[model samples]
Target: MQVLTIISGVVGIATSGTEVWHGIYTLPLPVMIVALLWTGARTREFFAER
Candidate 1:
């Protein structure tokens, strides 16, 4: 959970770059969305260990 936040922060910072891909500071919303989707709310507690 914490790691996901950190990853998002990093991506947000990178997305705020003025010269990102030679484009004016663009928010990496697409990447952020992807990150959020990939790491959902599922956790160890949600699974039953056999």
Candidate 2:
């Protein structure tokens, strides 16, 4: 899910340090940012309704 992307991104960066390079570690950031932006408003509305 999107939440996992965010968590994994944070963990990957924190644990990997400067070894990311042009690899999987670099992937999570764009994916996480896009996912959050794509779903943010809807998620907020859903929670606000509750």
TM-score of each: 0.32, 0.39
Model 2 CA lDDT for position 37: 75
Scored against the true structure, residue 28 in model 1 reaches a CA lDDT of: 52
Top TM-score hit: 2
Question: For model 2, how big is the CA root-mean-square deviation?
Answer: 4.4
Off by over 4 Å in 2: 18-50
Cα deviation at 3, candidate 2, in Å, is 0.6
CA lDDT of every candidate: 0.54, 0.66
Candidate 2 residue-wise lDDT, 1-50, digit = tens: 55676567667766876754534656666786777776877877877855
Alpha-carbon runs more than 4 Å astray in model 1: 17-50
Candidate 2 TM-score, C-alpha based: 0.39
Candidate 1 Cα deviation (angstroms), residue 23: 20
Q: How well does candidate 1 match the true structure, expressed as C-alpha RMSD?
A: 7.1
Give the CA lDDT, 0 to 100, for residue 2 in model 1: 45
Clashing pairs in 2: none
